[model samples]
Target: MRNPSLAPAPGDAVGALPSHWPRAVAWALVAATLVHAVVFIATVANPLVISDAWYFVDVFLRKYVDGQLTLGDFFAKRSAMDHALPFHKLLLLLNYRLFGVDLSVDAWIGFAFAVATLWLFRVALKRATPARDFADWPVQLAWVAMCAVYVSLNTSEIFEWPLLTLAFVALFCCFALYLAAWRALEGARAWPIVVAVFAVTLVSDGGGVIAVIAAALATGLYGLRTGETKPALRAIGAMVLACIAVKLVSWALAPPMQSIPMAGGPHAAAVSLPRLALAMTVPLSSGVLYPMQAQQVFHSFGHAVDMALRLGFIVAHAVFWWQAWRRRPTAAWFLAVATMLLFYGLCAGVLIGRVPQYGEAAFLQPRYIVFYQLHVVALLLMAVCWYVERRPSLDPANTKRVGGAMIAACLGLVLLQAPLDRQAWIRAPYQQAYVQRLAVQMEALADKPEVAPDKCMPQITVCRMPEPVRVRVVVFLRDHHLNVYSPAFRQRHGFEAD
Candidate 1:
């Protein structure tokens, strides 16, 4: 039976020809993505390496840039205590080496990566959608617009974080798999593309086991739909093998985490589900009301409201997913759901082992989930497109209604979150000033002839300064390792020295 939702084929003049609408939309998407990227770079360039990004940059500068990979620094001395992953550190080091130590250079590198990621998404959409006429224009436009929004909204963390880089790499791998599957189904030799996809997939993330499983399920579903199972099975097997090989190699070459005190395995497993759900809901909500704040009277009401908002967000995501499954049972949509669930599960498991005190634990931070957020957003966009496409006989009035509702919902969310975004931006200059102050102090100490090179480790305390000044001084001293200071010098400066 013919699919009821399929768009009617155009006449002979347009047969097998790419439509002008899709092409125009693609160009506009490219432009929008570029503009958002530019704005992101401009906003984040000088902010103090806050949170995980700072640690990643520190490790990269000390270990990769200094050529001390064997016995190098992780994010911080504290990171060694917590078993920090080296992947982000490595990327930061490469960025520093290629572009120099300037924060501006890092900003530009991030912007470039953001642009590349958008182009990759565009390519993936073109490969995944089956429609060939002007009707496909809306689908293409929606996909690009969603990506643009994600890039703009999450730039505070995702643009500079190595985890986001890993996510992009994973998306590119998925895109490659889509192309390879298409080629294989068409009876073309696609082994090379499969191999390339496998390679990229392996290097993208440590949790790539989850991605590989999702890819396998996607390939299996595609094969079943098309009545060709062997090639898909082979592709899945290849992907699995690639993931295993990468993990083995990483285990061998990277520093062992055994010495670091891991959160108890059982504990880690226990917290997985709740944390995953929390992470998924919190960022999508209108305000940040961390669960830990519920104990405080002032924030208790806000916390309750936040919980309600989270439930609403999850329901929204669920509705979109259901619509996609009903309209299009494509491999991509299925895979997107699988990946989201797997990642969420893994996150829940990991959270159980870590400290559960929400405020003190870094894992509770929403930015940690930025990697999976891309996939979630992609799935939602695909669902929306599928929903629109399924109403093939949709009248102009109904179409307008659906389109208007979608736009209104999105705009409302943006408006509701505008306060948070503004606060983040307003605080950026303060972070920049703090970093600049620390840098100046470090540079001054580094220039002093009396400070020995061996004492330049970050642990030394510069005690002489006032509390605020001392905090920056300590950060500076830790950064440069100026450990030995004369008590006389402290007296001269009207401060205590250690």
Candidate 2:
């Protein structure tokens, strides 16, 4: 039989809330999310090609166009060091086939995936709730807190950059896998869902393998604690076997240049162990700390404050975990812990891989903000669960005060993050200007093949293509009328694509 103490108090149910304040706060979070999305779409949603999209088009798409790469080979081939990115490649191919290579579409698609990730969290939150409904104030509070974290500007790269949608896809699959595992532990037939989601997650990014392993471990622990160990063991075994099978196949297809544990493997990271340890704590602090820039975070904050903040976050995490442990194991508690481990493992993997060479800046990359923000969401949810578990002991007036305080804190977080959001807003115009300049440079370079790479491109732009690939890419754009060369694109932005 399940422990009676594991259940939430009846007063904590949605039907028991006494005021309209929780609903109002929830609406405010939703509005904030919407405003963030609208602001992004309005200001920076252009199709000008840049960054990794350049390589994909110049290599994979070019190969397919030249008849050198078959559809099967295109999907199977790995790129960008160790990434097994067949799924991302598939999306790229579909966009090309459906709508001539358009970066704007890719950008919007990425935004869509980001929105979908938020929706997935809501689904997970629903499942974790004791009443399995958002009818209660605590559930509502947790949902809103997650929304605030999800819309953070720190992770704006995932929202704006077209290719980084791969991260969001991987996150979605990881969360789906956890939900499936939860179901299986409850005697539901969910192993197939787990298997399918795991396969998707495995190819989504290099960190997919680590995420799957973490999920399995968390699921197993939750099962063992709740007396459902057999199902948990089965889920873990399935995930482990799947990971091995996929890793072998991918290696056979194309051996990875370097192991993912550390960029150059264990020996490369051995000397940097102390810094790596400090960098690992970045995930905990990065969620809320908005340092000016990736490289400037340590510089701007100074060593003492940076170290203190990271250590403080560590203590905060420990307190929440202890609260979860003291209570009877609930799915909410387990999943919250699981989400934290899932991202924390990824953060550690990244820091271990890059911190030795790149230093603390590696952890502060804008792209990584997505991982840390989700980590913060998990921490917030853990706090919500703790609050729910304690609600029965508080008198009605005390309950009101605590609930009001929580809502105010969420609002305060939004206020604290406003500067970061404003930064994203201000940067959008500059990015648009840069893209326009890059288009002019590409158009000029296409016309003059002998032109030096350095002359036309900005020092800051990633569009500085090599001499060889540079000529081919511009010529391809010129002849095929893609990107800025597209007649339609030209008409819109004063350059033509066919």
* Winner by TM-score: 2
For each candidate, the alpha-carbon lDDT, in order, equals: 0.47, 0.65
The TM-score obtained by model 1 is 0.65
Residue-wise C-alpha lDDT for candidate 1, range 267-345, written one tens digit per residue:
3223456665555454444223333322232354766766775687677667755654454434345435444554454
Worst 10 residues of 2 by lDDT: 258-267
Q: In angstroms, how far off is 472's CA in candidate 2?
A: 2.8
Number of backbone collisions per candidate: 10, 13
Q: Which candidate is the best by lDDT?
A: 2
Off by over 4 Å in 2: 1-21, 75-80, 130-138, 254-278, 293-308, 455-466, 492-498
The positional error of residue 105 in candidate 1, measured at the CA in angstroms, is 3.8
Please identify model 1 stretches exceeding 4 Å from their true place: 1-33, 46-93, 103-107, 128-141, 159-203, 223-228, 255-280, 283-309, 320-325, 329-335, 338-346, 349-364, 393-397, 407-421, 440-498
